[model samples]
Target: MVHHTMATSTTRASKASSKINPMNLRLLRFLSTALIVGTLVACSTTPLPPASPPPASSTPPAVGAVPGDTAPLPPPLAQAKSRWVPVRWAELPGFSTDALHEAWNAWVKGCERPAPAFAPLCGEVRRLSIASPEEQRAWMVSRMQPYRIESLDGNAEGLLTGYYEPLMDAARVPGNGFNVPLYRTPAGLGERKPWYTRQQIDTLPEAQAALQGRAIAWLRDPVDALVLHIQGSGRLRVTEPDGSQRLVRVAFAGTNDHPYQSVGRWLLDQGLVRDATWPGIKAWIAANPQRVNELLWSNPRYVFFREEPLDGLDAAFGPRGAQGVALTPGRSIAVDRQSIPYGTPVWLASAGPTAQLGRLVMAQDTGSAIVGAVRADYFTGWGPEAGDVAGRLKQGLRLWALWPRQP
Candidate 1:
């Protein structure tokens, strides 16, 4: 069945990494609010000119930091894909009411690989983890500037979608009803640019031969296999041959190099269904079971995976995003790097069918479909409830980049 999420059709293979730097409590106090107000006034005198479009390359920008010097901070520069217009703290909706301490967790996680602009603030960010929402808000107002993100044409509204890591059951070896396989990257995957299509992998003897003995786990549902492939990562409860059960994560290892084609979109275009969400697609499949293969083969793209053990601490976080940090359930977002760089803190707001969101989120990941200024993919975390939200969320969005202020 076709699931709907920005990650469903757009996620690329990425390994997971997690780190949180140690804390030091002796950092200086907050900058004066009056000084920050004055600086904002000066910076807001004129809107920055539009920046050149972001590079087309898939490689992410290098991690960097400002020099550890006593000099005043430099003026903020425009992003490769969006312009920044400085705004007052009052411009952010629901800013005062948000439980900023919740966002602080994500902030500290991001500090594990602080961006050049945010590097200097990591110590203070760490120290404030246990601070009150009032203190966090005060520090944010005193130390950072909020810039309303806009496209080259000055549009502030864009799309908001949601994604989550799926959770499912698996067998260490194919059994009773667990016949579908999740294989590791097959040998010589690099030899062919666009590897065997989904249909080929399912039917071609040579393709199956290459993947033999490569199955890390077997799942019960082919639809579930598609779900795992679409989401790019998942948690599997595997029952081993020895009758031991363990939890594990299967992260994105590689793909068949085929371009992702959304089966939901295909179904919509074919007029085979009115609602193209996962449930609707499944309904159609259940009614016309004979056409299951036809629906599955609509998009040829296939993803491969690598299994990672899920330890005690690992269970608390989602898979590592593009920023190389484990995503905080409600506080991490996948954004187009052209508009918002990875590791930047973003103020996100949206209200629609699936959710009403107004809070701070770290720009920790990016998806191919999550393009354009003011766009975002909210990480709803893992499991069934998160999956329900991800499959249904598609709404309007507005963004403000919370950038570092000059000391």
Candidate 2:
């Protein structure tokens, strides 16, 4: 999602625009605060699996070491560039200490549309509902085996980045201060593999004609809109034509088919900014307002979105991910579908520049950039605080997929 200053509007056009009223500004602050604290933490129950046999020996395993348990191991599933090596649950860092109850929500969501291998386990998973963290941990130990994921070249370490659902102010119709358009997918999008480039979408008559009357919302900043495109989904504080305001979500519908090109990389290549973060990009844009469009057009990829209602419980959850489950704020991850199947429970351990994270996360989503066996995009949830964490979260990472033990 796009990142920008949450302060009052300072642009001359925005100041002159009637849309930037006190009510709107108040709503923006309220939304920002809501986004930060909207993440719900609740306790629920699921069914537990039948008990398994005790370990071969009564002795506890060494810390960070996998014990030689006599549990049966399943044959490894082949992937394009990764292999899974079976390991005991004791090998997972912080596995016993993590708040598994927190992650249970995401796991239960995954069960709604489970992977083929995981389908049979879903009923038991639900039975474990309302289980304590320790109970959940013990149940997992009895029912699942942790598989260390390694790349083809034998590397267990890989990169981890973060992403979130951004929140922005928008208008249902073009007027007042909102002028930039966020479009739905154009007709005949399937006709072209790589659709019109960003520059062409803004300049070509045919492209413009195709998108006419398709604007889902209008924003004050085109750069913010670009961020929404990159993030693939966002929450909009939309002012309707009837002057009513409501919170709604615009999820990824389709892309232009062109490969994603990072505008931050463009800035780095141009040597205009050493730090290509969202703040840095915004600073660059502030200083070079005349060339903001040039910076945006540098990337060819364009994304489209579909509007979703944000009412009742829907407001508390995020868009459904690749696993077809509504993503849990701190427990959902996007991985290489080839390396780790959607709906799998994963143990993530990372220590790097941004933060240290060791937790149980579900592989519920995927991204274009999230390639390779060890690569993943950690979903940080919605709001600016989440965005801040996501923007700075490139780190050294290791992962273990926890799958059911074979009989």
Candidate 3:
């Protein structure tokens, strides 16, 4: 009952089986050729035709086959990789004895804080001694004027703070006096506070004569350049190690929510007042014109300025107003801060390499707009000049923040 039948070429349908299906084979060969041509096209690297000139154009990113690839891009701000070698003063084109001392002064001050094991090659500033008491007192008065000099040593939007006597290079050589306007804030405007009065200042004959003599010596010497500082309170741009860019926003000095620095406090530093009554002291200086030197001795902090913008401090961070955030230097190690809370220490190694690559620092500040997983704000230090510098610094940063417990 099981029968098997096998068809052969010569069987009943042999004629049909022997017929060649040339069309089917030809179709298969055509498809194979098509696939090979497509692969070759994918590997091709022919140049594109040039476009006609447009009316206006900015440089475009590199164009190729791939999409979403921003690599191989040139640095838009500074160079791809900037080389910052340690430059000896004598080796520089115009290094001088005075410059050396100034740099040294900066070095000394920086060393006073928690500095690296090895220090920058800068020097400390030396104060000039005034021989005559009258000259010293006069010099001190002019020195206290709030904003009266140009800073060749700092960037714009920066603040200035510290100790040094610089010439108020306006009109005549500073004698024993000078004055500047202190506008009433949140209360009135165009109101000027006359800091040094003539008669009351003359009461301290010993201190006055001493101050005058010290000033004269300073005037004789030619070390009267102003220091420009960058106060942290705004956008900052810095370069990265891998030829990339980063933007770091920094913050203000002082503990947050503190009152503005008063000139009377400076007076206390100079030993001008036994007890501080800023209004009374100012009134007394006004009443005593000839005694201005004693009044000058009471003044605190040196004055600095550039010829643009209202005091950047008031505009950026007066009361609720904010020029930028507040921070401790080198505290933010990474760019992202949500994980790294304010007051955490960080080392910015990936963005900017340093002498201490993995050094620990404190994070004493925060920024309003400092969002994302990789962003940071560096807090530059005190005064108006520093704020100017802080405003201008922007970069794409790769940083690392240190935990307080870790550091």
lDDT of 3: 0.24
Q: What is the lDDT of residue 107 in candidate 2?
A: 81
TM-score per prediction, in order, is: 0.81, 0.83, 0.21
Tens digits of per-residue lDDT for model 3 on 275-387? 44423444556666676544443322222121212122222211111212212222221122343443322333211111112122333333333334443344333233332
Residue-level lDDT tens digits of model 1 in 127-231: 877776666777787788778898988878888787888888899999889999999999999998889999999999999999999999999988888888878
Check candidate 1 and list the clashing pairs.
Answer: 65-116
In TM-score terms, candidate 2 sits at 0.83
Candidate RMSDs in order: 13.1, 11.2, 35.0
Better of 2 and 3 by lDDT: 2
Worst 10 residues of 3 by lDDT: 4-13
By lDDT, the better pick of 1 and 3 is 1
lDDT of all predictions, in order shown?
Answer: 0.73, 0.73, 0.24
- Ranking of all predicted structures according to lDDT, beginning with the best and ending with the worst: 2, 1, 3
**Alpha-carbon runs more than 4 Å astray in model 1:** 1-77
Q: In lDDT terms, which candidate is top?
A: 2
Q: What does the lDDT read for residue 218 in candidate 2?
A: 96
- Which of the two candidates, 1 or 3, achieves a greater TM-score against the reference? 1
